[model samples]
Target: MRAFVAIVPPEPAHADLDAFVAPRRALDSPWRWTPAHLWHVTLAFMAEVPESGIDEMVEEVAVVADSCDPIPLRLKGAGMFPHAGDARVMWTDVRPTDPRGLGDLERLALRTRSACSRIGVPTAGGDYRPHLTLARSRRAVDATSWLDAMEAYSGPAWLAQEVTVFVSRANRSGRPHYEAEARLPLGRR
Candidate 1:
């Protein structure tokens, strides 16, 4: 199955982002916007894991979760990945700061990749920039209007208590439908 590890944004935060994107959804742009419930910060893309490897993947993910603490993350601002010059993904920034010290979400991503590495799957790649992906455009957008819209988009502060490993399946709509394969609680340690 196609899979990925991600930090699920708390519900209140999701609602906030939902309100932000609702109006923009009608802009007639060449981008596909993600459903509000699907908004999340991807920790690592685990790629395709056969059914036989799934059980072990779940076990490893639990270990990583137990070693982590719940993180307080606030969604803020907006930016396009790869810049507006050649934008593909449009996302909102997140500030993962709290619990006195340590970047819990960032470390969790590293540990997730590290755990998969031991099994020779090599999950670690890309600089970890925490953001909630809003849309993916086939063509670059005039982000100026979008950026201006974001200025008034406000969502509640959220506490992420768990990370989820999901199995994704592409459908006729060309959108990926996701199912939770495993959920690992944070601050278990």
Candidate 2:
């Protein structure tokens, strides 16, 4: 299965970002805006996981969650993937509420990746910059203007209480949709 680990923000956070994106989505543009329901902050993208290995993966993730406490996070700022010069994906940063603190989400990503590594599946290799995807485009485009407008956006603060493994699939309309395969509460052994 094509799966990933993520934290789903609470309703207030969604409401905050929805207000920000709803207007921009109405305008005709090249970007294919993601529906509000699909918004998430990916911890690790495990592109391919064998069905037989799923149970073990979930167990490892549960262990990681027990060792990690619930984190206070806020969705803020904006940026593009593969640099803004020629960008294909746009997103809002997921960050700790405190200006200075241990990097909670980054550590979570590393632990998630480590768990998957133990399962013999390597996650997408890269330095983790936690962010919630907002939109995508087929071709690269200059997004400075969009970045400037979104740079100041800071959504509602929420507690990251649980982590989920999501199975990705394309719906009838060809839009990507995610289904939760496993959910584990943070700080629960």
Best by lDDT: 2
Residue 169 error, candidate 2, Å: 5.7
Clash number for model 2?
Answer: 0
Any runs in candidate 2 off by more than 4 Å, and if so which? 99-102, 169-177
Candidate 2, clashing residue pairs?
none
CA deviation > 4 Å runs, candidate 1: 97-102, 169-176
Per-residue C-alpha lDDT of model 2 across residues 1-189, encoded as one tens digit per residue: 788889998899999999998888888877899888888888888888887877888888889988888889999999998778788999999888775423877888899999899879779868888888999999999888888988889988789999988877778999877789898899875
Q: What's the TM-score of every candidate structure? A: 0.88, 0.92
Candidate 1 on 77-155: residue-level lDDT in tens? 8888788656788888877556642376778888888897777556646887877899998776667666666656556
Candidate 2, residue 121: lDDT? 78
